[model samples]
Target chain A: MTETSGFLTSNGMAIDLTDLTIDKAHKHLKSRDFSAMELADAYLEVIEKKNPEINAYLEIYDDVKKQAQQAQEIFESKEENIVTGIPLAIKDNILIKGKQASAASKILEGYTATYTATAAHKLIEKGAVFLGRANMDEFAMGSSTETSAFGVTKNPRDLSRVPGGSSGGSAAAVAMGGALAALGSDTGGSIRQPASFCGCIGLKPTYGTVSRYGLMAMGSSLDVIGPITKTVADAEIIFKAICGKDKYDSTSISGSINAVSPKKEYIIGIPREILEIEGIDKDVKENFEASIKKFESLGFKTKEISLSNIAYALASYYILMPAEVSSNLARFDGVKYGLHKKGANLLEDYLNTRGEGFGVEARRRILLGTYVLSAGYYDAYYNKANDVRRLIADDFENVFKNVDIIITPTTPTPAFKIGEKVNDPLSMYLADIFTVTANIVGIPALSIPSGAVIREEKELPLGLQLMAPHRGEHSLFMVGSQFLGE
Target chain B: MITRTDIEKLASLARIRLSEKEKSLFPEEINSVLGYVEQIKNADASNAKALQKETVYNVMREDINPDESGVHTKDIVDEFPKKEGNYLKVKNIL
Candidate 1:
């Protein structure tokens, strides 16, 4: 109920940016409590005050006021939808036509999107005001935002700590009150881990629910576009708007896949093998147990289940993800869009352009991918990884039949210090241990703020992840809303 | 283990030019990563079915010209790094 004083309209109607949710704002806008222009100005004021320190937004769109003006017109015409005038921060990887989407890598610097992504286009159709493009790890590769060519996005809670990536800025922008919600792509824990680190709700819907036509491809098989929001209901609102079949992306499924009715009670499955993994923070484990107890107290039953191939999920992800990255990124040669460097010959042109444009981590992944897919090692590395991926998927398939949902800690630890895992890539990869399985199995996963743990005298947020069967987003929302008391 | 020579070959195959510093450092870094993921080799996946085995199917759509298709061909062409008129100019393949 705390409201910032300066965000008042001419009629003295005050807007509360700190406690504003999509539904609240929609009701307020419909009742003429405040105009959409006023709402956007309020967020712009906060971003102006906070972004320099937080480094959450890479670019604040020049057309925000124009977009807000259009949204106000919709309100006047009484045609405003739920998302009309709701300001959102888009990850740099998801394109909006005429906007620059770099994916936080120099490789695609100055690249203007010729076409908007299906998800962003959906938001545009709903009259959502795009606040800005948020920063992320270059090409959505690193778990920490430190890999961004622009800069690392600091966690709003503690300026010294990282906002976990590769959707770090999207999460930070929401946490810092810059945007109501944001869109982020999860290849492996990109959206959920960052949301967990920044104390927000992030949902990665089933792999085919959201179209990937314009999301910068990282891992084609694993990548998904989802919402990062302040509340579970807000996340569901954005997901409903964006999820559906698209002729543009053949993999997209109909939105009706979420039409399943909510049950009276739900069963929560806990993977014993994942919790037994090494290097999980003591506090995170404790927080997860507390969350299970909270769910149990709410009449949800918890059962311990074993996923035999869960141990290899991360390894499978690392191999399969990089292999896909190598193939997808091959389009960034000198002749096409994005940064280009000229050389004496065609071969040298490709080498020079890619070498100079890509960051160290990007190059490293490309090389790793190339090595795995190489002729001699193809069967040994790439094929073997695929087989393990199948096994991991099978493990989830069998488990879902016994339980309605699975739960785990979103990340092994809360947000680490900005530079804690930068020099060590392996350590950074470990951050996705609990999150990668959802991506590997192509299921819907939701990460909600469980509670906070005090670290260094600052309260750092922790999150618990709930994963449902394929296209089981309704169950996730039902349990998530009950858990968050929304 | 990935050697420096192997790193060079990968960089070459990937069409990326790595500096000598990268060449020297990547062997160790890639080896560590490969070492971690190498555990999958021991996984027994004989009973597991291939991904997309039943799901893989061609999605056919009627072909349409760029003008009729609603695709912004001009915008796509405008993104080319080096363009001569409407055609993208690339280095000679021969």
Candidate 2:
């Protein structure tokens, strides 16, 4: 036994899982430095200590030991995968059979998943240990997890601020070292934004790259499942494991991560007009600019580009996403599954169940969706938004012809105080201003932690977002790994 | 400006019951969001083809008799608020 005595611990346990990455964890398990049970215990100890204050995990899976035992068996049998014995946090939206998968909505309260998500199934197949279901924005509707019906997840770096959402809890779990990595579903910046706020690496693979068979439907076309990890290489490992076509998810494609013609002298495009928009914090902008300078120093060239229709991305995303939301969420009517409320009639039952089941933001979006897709307004709002979406995609296609990737700040600011923008729905919607474009265009994007800036005496980290063309996750990994010095 | 009547009409359309307070507050909130999204009307998409509907084709699989297979029937039936055998018991519509 190698002893595995190289971690900082407060309780004086022989092992500390906080600082161990997947590679190190797997190495230790293989070398018998520490048993997988010891690693799970270390994480459990920390989770027991810190989870209450942070509200990161909705449920710490009871099967942690069972899963670790299986992984330990795999390791002992010399059949270990990269993720074997590594604990991972799963976002609440992804279904894990026999476990409560609430999507942070009361409608799904006490609801157990019938079958496992393909992405999660793949990870479990590779011998990964699932820690628990992490909290999220209720139905992934909000940019901050304050909207979660389960309760807001406090940022680990600063208790007052949010960890970003709707994957806030997943990011927080990884950031606080409660889990080595996490699976986060991104629909308009949920993964990347939270990762940026929590000082971790988050990737949103191309729309069809990761199967969405069991992820709760947010915006069907735009939603994607990705990883949140401490390092880009770790993110890459999880992404490769989870991404590919699944028989259950028709939208899923057999993605090829290795197929990329890497640019000799990579050109990073900056839509200066979009960057010049107001509301971006000075410190955030300075940090972003510093990242750009660093990239330049590393021999990558920057070019000014114009995505003319990009200014309208946020507006377009809101319209289209809500439209999809209203349609996809129509499945949650009282009769079939989830919360059911009795009423005078079937219609009354639906109304009461939905109204009572859905939170404020969810109800608001459903109504907005109905209004936009309504008869008189369909051509004006819904159709126009779809066209503008195409125009946005066209802008990306036009730009990527010259540049290898597009770079922007993940969000306008770092972590903001919880309840800061809750009342102002428009302002809250703007939290994803920089991120919705990638989802709109169906391209892969990565948020790499650039550095931190002091906000209210707390060091809040900022991220630099790099967007690449469809099936261009390898390029993203290349640039991300280079930026992270992995 | 969206009136309270419009908000009520939208609630009815969406099949979501709303409180009297929500009926009053939602108009202002929904209008504000709609007002922000009204910018899409300015985009020149007259010639742009609607790819969101057309380009994305639904994937089809070889026919599998789900009813006979009883694959997810139990899981689906278990969620019904009122159930009898395999049927989801609902209020009499007829």
Candidate 3:
């Protein structure tokens, strides 16, 4: 057997799985340097070797070989595309027909999807292979994958630390060389935060840009299916495949909305107020400053702008996200699908099924959501949060007039050690501060690997977030590609 | 501040049976969350109603079966906790 990057291929040939991006893999597959089966086997080999320690995948799909064979046929027929043979990890919340999609909760333990999510379906149509369902926070609730019933997903960079949630598994899989790329859902920074921690490129497409037909809904207004990959170009490839209007989701807009041309010289906006926030990590701040200087050196102009309502973004999101979550997740009763428990009566059945099925974080959010939406508090909390949401949207609208993009550190700090903030929920929620406003305002945001810092003899990766106006994913892709020198 | 009584009420409304440990622990934990989110009270939302009015619109579609009838019926029916001959069996409300 030969060795490449210290990894061996199944056919006694050397292939570096760590260096393979979607584009590079497509080129290699096109040239017949290696077959699709070899690529899939290389990744599967890595998953078998590393997934036990990382806990990145909850279930490795049984049909991977079959899928690779189909991709091989496409290459033989000369009908292959960029993702024709790419092995991808899908987060647990996304559905592929007849596959178990548990959202990393016991509630959906045995539930099989009756239909495929539009995004995953698009990727499958393009001949991508499904590796498995990646682990995530239950109902996409927690900032760390610690809330998942399966297990916590540790960062590949440092085994002691968490690979940020709720798309922790997706990010970790790519970071650990287990998959070329993965699909993840972002609701309140779920995708971006984890990408930051794992140093992958995560793109939360413009809200309603990608169809959410078969996705397990968390917050209807905030959820968007996105891609986590090694490069911004890979993310763009996946985004283009999945985004468009669909009859199933009425919120999905037509393709013309995102058809804007790229600008010659883009102006970037930096929110100065973010630096004033408490608990801003020193490395994160220094890395952000260096990123700004790097952008300036690349001939892009930077302006100090203000998002006045941004300070209220995290607070507003807590109220609004849970409010939608309580309503969206109410469908998980025992009478339908998922886990069921016998009790004295119908009410007890729901109570037992939901109570025992949902983890502590899910229960907390449900209670918090119920409290805010209940009588006597609805006007004060729920209604007020909506008002603040409108103001945040307005703040974005006002800022986009002055600049083409807004930049921030994806998280306040790099990946924290697992179990470090589990007991303290508020501190865990603080991890989402910089990444939430994009969701709050329904804009597209991308997290690119900015730099890293040494922590406890391990170099932990950090990310910089770039947000654009609604349907302005073009700007994000343009700047992101330039920033990463891709 | 959230009290134990409020937590009980919320748990009941949410249809979650909290254990004694949760009942003891949730008050402080939830209070911390609510206390942190309490900062939203400072936002000047006088124009919030106007902003809300601007974005509200009904999305309507022609009522037609997008897929073949019964294409997903069997799969959905197979998942029922209690089922009888294509019918979902549930506890009698009465």
Q: Model 1, A1-486: lDDT tens per residue?
A: 112537888679878788899999999989989988999999999999999999999999999999999999998988889999999999999999999999998878999999899999999987999999999999999988888999899999899999999999999999999999999999999999999999999999999899999999999999999999999999999999999999889888885766656788899998866777899999998999999999999999999999998999999899999999999999988687998898889998899999999999999999999988889999988988888988888888889888999999999998899889998899999999999989988999999999999999999999999999888999999999999999
Considering only chain B, report the TM-score of model 3.
0.86
Docking class of 2: medium
The candidates score, on chain A by TM-score, as follows: 0.98, 0.96, 0.98
Better of 1 and 2 by DockQ: 1
In the predicted model 3, the residue pairs found to clash are none
- Model 2 chain A: worst 10 consecutive residues (lDDT sum): A1-10
- lDDT of each residue in A1-486, candidate 2, tens digit only: 011334433434356555577888788788887777778777877788889999999999998999989989999899999998888999999998888898999888888888899999999998999999999999998888999998999999999999999999999999887888999999999999999999999999999899999999989989999999988889889999999888788888884676667767778898778778879999988888898889998888899889989999999999999999999888888787789999988888989999899999999998899888999999889888888989999889899999988999999999999989999899999999999999999999999999999877878899999999999898999898888788
**Against the true structure, what is each candidate's TM-score?**
0.98, 0.96, 0.97
Question: How much does candidate 3 score in TM-score?
Answer: 0.97
Per-residue accuracy of model 1 over B3-22 as CA lDDT, tens digit each: 99999988999999999999
Candidate ranking under DockQ, highest first, comes to: 3, 1, 2
Number of the candidate with higher lDDT, 1 or 2:
1
What would the per-residue lDDT of candidate 3 be over residues A1-486, giving only the tens digit for each residue? 012455444545577776677888899889887888888888888889889999999999999999999999999999988889899999999999989999999999989998899999999998999999999999898888999999899899899999999999999999999888999999999999999999899999999999999999999999999999999999999888889998889888786645656788899999978988999999899999999999999999999999888999999899989999999989999788999988889999999999999999999999989988989889889899988999989888999999999999999999999999999999999999999999989999999999999999999898999999888888999999999999
Instruction: List residue ranges in candidate 1 displaced over 4 A.
Output: A1-5, B50-53, B66-71
